[model samples]
Target chain A: MEALYHVAPFTGYIYPNESVVPWTVLIVIYPYLTGLVAGAFTMSSLYQVFGMQRFKPVAHFAMLTSLCCMLIVPLPLLLHLGHAERALNPMITPHTTSAFAVFGYAAGFYVVLLLLENWFVFRPHIVQQAQQRKGLLGLFYRVLTLGSYDLSEKAMSYDRKWIFALAVVGIPGAHGLHGYVGFVFGSLKSREWWSSDLMPPIFLFSAIISGVSLLIVLYALSCKLRKVPIDLDCVKGMAYTLWGFMMFALMLEAVEFASLMYRGREGIEMILEYVKGPLVIPFWTVQLGICSLLPVLLLSFMIWQGTKGKTLIVGVVTCAMLVLVGVLMMRWNVVIGGQEISKTGKGLLTYHMPWVEQESGLTAAILLMAPFVLLAVAVRLFPPWEDGKAAH
Target chain B: MENKVEKLEEDGRRKFLRLFGAAIGGGGMAIAANSLLPEAAATETPAKAAIPAIPGYDWSQHHWAFGVDATKCIGCLRCVEACKVENNVAKDPNHFRTWVERYVTLEGEEKARIDSQQDPVNIAAAGAEGKYRFANRYKDAKVEKAFFVPKLCNHCTHPACVQVCPTGATYKTDDGVVVIDHTYCIGCQYCVQACPYGARFFNEEKRVTDKCTWCYHRITKGLNPACVEVCPVSARVFGDRNDKQSPISIFLRNNRVTVLKPESGNAPNVFYVGIDKEVG
Candidate 1:
């Protein structure tokens, strides 16, 4: 039952086991998706904690987006595992020293915190909606309330206090959630392509960038769908922040690469050959040229002297979409491109994503969209666009 | 009034003491609960129950290690064949518990030519007449030196694979061979990525990460590993490293030996004799 693909030809020596790359495109999606969760959560905090009143309309939407994405983050990981049932072992009996062991703890902590914060923010609204609805829908909202019927001013004030505390704690918790993913790649001393101290911070910054980009795109799409006017200030503010963070992330990556090149490390030549070989397309074209550079220019121009109406919205949306693709390309390069070069420095390994296989690229693409479907369901329940609807 | 105030102070001190005691007790219980979980989860397979003790030999008394004398290897690949038969490994060239590499370098050549006997499809195609053949792989007129270097899992004392396994699915045994508990493996492939020697592979058929176990099942029963037993030139050696009488110990003491990628600090149990610098 071998998947059909040409074994990538290799020159020089490669140990036999390395001929097939074990970590596939699904693993790439794991980190990329987790980054979005972290980044989007941070955007929500910009309004809740930092008091960025311009971001008010999108704050709840951003939090819901982050939660929806976070819920789906573990799916790709579970799908990639050879024995999915044993995934629970990490939570029950985690290997303390292993970097991956933190996945369970960090993800659990963040998910619970997000759920608590969501409850705090939406409790009063749920209580109100509960009274208006009937039958099963009313029962659903009632269950969600957990029998706390207090919609009083005092109860609302307490909820606000809790929300503030959770948001503050969540800032670093979000960083740890994504930063731990970076540590998994960075701690592997075996592969020279990933072994960098800069990987954690670099991942964190890119996460925030992609996250903000995703929010911008989603927000724009939502406005267009519901016939609501796009919040110009929100879009402009996010554009400026997105450009700044993307530049910082790009600089970090450049510095990391430059330092490695300057030192002429032992396995750097193999990676150089990889950059010349099959890696040229994703590494140079999609990740750097289209995704990174194009978005940077588009956003820079827009941020300097932003236009209003459809033109500004289109520009922001385009750049946001580009950055999203670019961030994902970066993840793909890190996970899959890193595996293309053999650790022995003698040759390259190749991978082709089979269309029909469960772990194939097609399946990964479908799995990536699952979160949006979940987000649709979440939107119905929480109504992230309520404020925007009222303004309209 | 003074007596009443003294009573109030006494009551506050008692409440404080009780809370402190409860906090310490709760903390102690949490620590105890944490330590006990991994112990319960570390249960070995029932296969260990069926393993018989070696006659008059205590398994705990000695440490095991492997050694390879590269100078003695003849590139016959009998060990590769034997290992597949013994372990029920797939017949595909991509799957191997042990494989042999041949390195050739002509005089005045700046680079060495290295080839491992993987890729069964090419091997079968070349030997269409039902006989194995390598068509003039070393046809250079100025051949300086050629040697066969057999490789397997080094079973390192400080194994990187074991260190990176998220669920502790891959672990080092007390007797020193690193083995994977296939049932428990999530197969995230982190262990495969961590291995510097590229000894680990995901078994496509079984859907689990597989590697050389140094024949733990056979060795514990006082039998040589399939590779060592089938080596016609005595190139592969396995024995108790603690015993001076063992062939591995004698070879290590007598020869200038090296392990692959010594800079990795894995402290491989497998030692190679007369190994070229080009070997991984």
Candidate 2:
């Protein structure tokens, strides 16, 4: 006797097993990653396209981090789905069922835009230098340039126009990526903690901080390792930007809490249960203490000293930790924190990250590390600094 | 002679290896295919065949639209066992087919226990103290009006899972059952997390979420849902909510029934009578 039968195919788009809580976790995490990509890229453009002198040296690192995080941006989302293979259909053949389809668009579009923008901006110098090196090194640059090796005066000018246009186009795509992510959570009518009017803006601000912090750290590390001179102005400039964005993100989160608590609605109890008890550690320790505060402190010290090597080292360490802790907390809070409340509102929901989960703890950590590994590899290969005047 | 023996031995070794590999590979493939393509032979018979759900598939109308005369329940666990078999829900403690929730409320001089699992079935809490101390099946109210209300998926009309699915891997059947396409599902747990009812489960082994599915297997075969069929008191009701003359339509007309999260706009198809305010 037949015990079971295969269910519907593509037509069965709803999750058969969904209870109320887990769905909210997914919508929140995806946007957080996209916001980081957008925020970081925007900082890069401030120097490269807008001609901010202090931000000039920070451009290459910004571009590199953006590339790193952008490629793996969809990892958490893909991990949550029980059927990973079917994850691609939204990207492959998009059918707009809901606003969520916008994520599908942002994912495909940004990969190309980032690659092209980075190529046009970096190609001329890369190709020129690659031509000087012989054998495999030269061949690597040649292949990278893809036969577009004209480094003439007009060619460089044309490259600038391309970068400007790509950056302009990228601004909206970046917003869409983060906005779409915010929309995922905001649209849910269920769970009060998730339903918020200010979600998207909060996402954007935090993402930018994550981005600039990544550059501050990366720039310092590159300088120290390569024994190059420190660029105080660039570090300070990015720090200022990071500080401004972090304040905004923190304020927005506060406002969200304020608005929800002001109503003292039925769901407020659930939110308080999370903010006070189980979530106190991750929220206060990692998010407030490590991710935001320590970096802000170091960056402030660097800003005050405004000196050469010392400022760079402090800023570098601070930036590295902020980028790592800030974003990781953002992911953790959204995924686990949102589910901390039960629909009953009588108690809390439980989620201990089990090993066998598709997005198991270890795999998630590795996916997040992909950016640094790629950055290290990119630096060894491309060396984003100018000839001998590398900024440590 | 030595060369010939060597060649013969090598050939023998190769054949043995080939047979061994084939056996292992064939066995593995069978297990893999079984999970991917579940068996349907039993469901193909005339009387037992799974029926294709027709549109206007309102679950509120199913013959098993659960209704409890709250006075009868005494916190037994029989219904939970009956439900697991009907749904083939995982018995792996992590998965629950049905569980009795017994609640006690004390107000001033009034004290009462409301265990939804009826007097005949509350195995887990049989010997425990409650309103109906000497009851198994609800013959009459024992202590100051304790009520029982069975809970399951509210099988929504505008299910959030159907809305958030990226790959169209989730959809509502014409009969209104929310079905999952495991093959097309990317194991993305979005739908699993999105469902407010927590009626969803990620079939961790298959990497696709699976949940109550309302026993679509039995329904199409013109049988009641697993929980409905096993009730000794004939309390479960199933019918076409869209059909004016259906039993559900008559039941709803005669009784006061309510749905979960009426504001969620998911349009739950499950209806409850003799309700609890905190059912959501």
Best by TM-score: 1
Question: Which residues of candidate 2, in runs, are more than 4 Å off?
Answer: A1-33, A92-95, A129-137, A293-324, A354-358, A387-392, B1-79, B97-100, B107-145
Query: Which lDDT tens digits does candidate 1 get at residues A252-289?
Result: 99998887678777777777888877767897899889
Residue-level lDDT for A47 in candidate 2: 76
Candidate 1: which stretches are off by over 4 Å? A1-9, A386-392, B1-57, B119-135
* Predicted complex 1: DockQ: 0.35
DockQ (CA atoms), all models: 0.35, 0.15
lDDT of 2 by residue, B1-280 (tens): 9757755774675466346535543433332232222112111112113344455444434433334433345444456566666656654323444444554444433433443332233424345322112244434434334454555666566677766665556666656666766666666665655667656665645767676666777676666677666656545566666666766677788878778678767777777666566545
Pick the lDDT winner: 1
Clashing pairs in 1: none
Please, what are the lDDT tens digits per residue for candidate 1 over residues B1-280?
A: 9756755774574466346535533443343244224322323322243433557656566688888999899887788888888998766666678888878788999777777776443375456422222345656568898888998999887777877777777877666778888878887889999998889988766678999988877887778999999888899888998789898888888888889888876888899898887788
lDDT of each: 0.79, 0.61
Cα deviation at A102, candidate 2, in Å, is 3.6
